[model samples]
Target: MSFRDRTHAGRELALRLVERAGSGHLIDVLVLALPPGGVPVAAEVAGALHAPLDVLVAGEISTPVRPETAIGALVADDPPLYDRRSLAMMHLSEDRLGDVVVGERNELHRREYLYRGRRPLPSVNGRTVVLVDDGLTTGLTATAALRFLRRHGPTRLVLAIPVGNARTLSSLRDECDALVCLQQPPSLHAVGEWYEDFAPVSDTQVADTLHAFHATA
Candidate 1:
């Protein structure tokens, strides 16, 4: 399945979550989006579930050699979550990525502060937390977000995306209580390929989205 854009994919994803909500699968729901891409998609979901929306800033760590590849990820003030296998294959160690991690972490904090301002991350404890992203590739960023949310004592943790690779999605089952994806194709080269209008989301867009949500909320 393909989408017109993140908003379109989000609408489709929202329908399924609405079904789950109707069946009593979701309760005391709280939607946390991985900005800035996840913000638009998650707005649809928070609307459908009538839940409060928030942002969970996570960053991907990669080397200059192959910056497209995510060797690890991080969320908030937590330690970096690295893929040991990937590190071994790349012949690199955590120490080797220190500068990269520092840069990513700094950017992550900047986005978090921009999107949230003085507001602390909403209490996920005892709430059904739905972690939303536009799509999953290697799933490194989502995995990091999920692990951080898990440690926060959420009653039930869920990871939701519009599209992803079937194999990668299956491997992330243990990260959350429920995993929702609209399409899991045999092979997904990249997330943008599935979207007709895969535009770059800016920091201003992210802040505006959060501001709009908070205005009425």
Candidate 2:
């Protein structure tokens, strides 16, 4: 199944989530999206559940030579999550990735500040947090974010995505309390392949989405 766009995917995904929660009441649920792609999808979920929307700043640490290839990901105030399998295949070690970690860390903090203004981060203690992403690919970023949030002691953690690679979902679903994925394609291709309008989400778009959701919530 192909989604029209992130918003359309968001609406469809929200319906499943609402049904899962029963009666559409999610008072303890906090919706956190991994920006900038996750923001648009998350806006719809936040609207549906009447939950506060926020950004969880995490970044992919691209490989040294092939910048498009992610070797790992870094979440806020946490050590970079290196893909052991990828690192072994590349014959790379954590020591050789100092520069990549530094760069992604800088970017991660920048996005955190840019997405969130003066408002303090919402307390996650004892809350059922639903982390949203537009799509799941390598799963490194989502894993890192989940690990990072673990320190905050959330009552339960859920990973929600519009579409994902089937292989990745199998592994990730077990990591979170629950996983809400609309599609897990068997043929395993790029996340964008599942969407008809998989356009790049801009910084302004991320900010606007959060602003719009927060205004209503």
What TM-score do all the candidates reach, one by one? 0.97, 0.94
Q: Where does candidate 1 have its weakest 10-residue lDDT segment?
A: 109-118
Winning candidate number (TM-score): 1
Cα TM-score of candidate 2: 0.94
Each prediction's whole-model lDDT (CA): 0.92, 0.86
Candidate 2 local lDDT, 34-131, one digit each (tens): 99889889989988887889988888887857788888988877888988988999989999999778887988778778878767678899998999
lDDT of 2 at 51: 81
In order of listing, the candidates' clash counts read: 0, 0
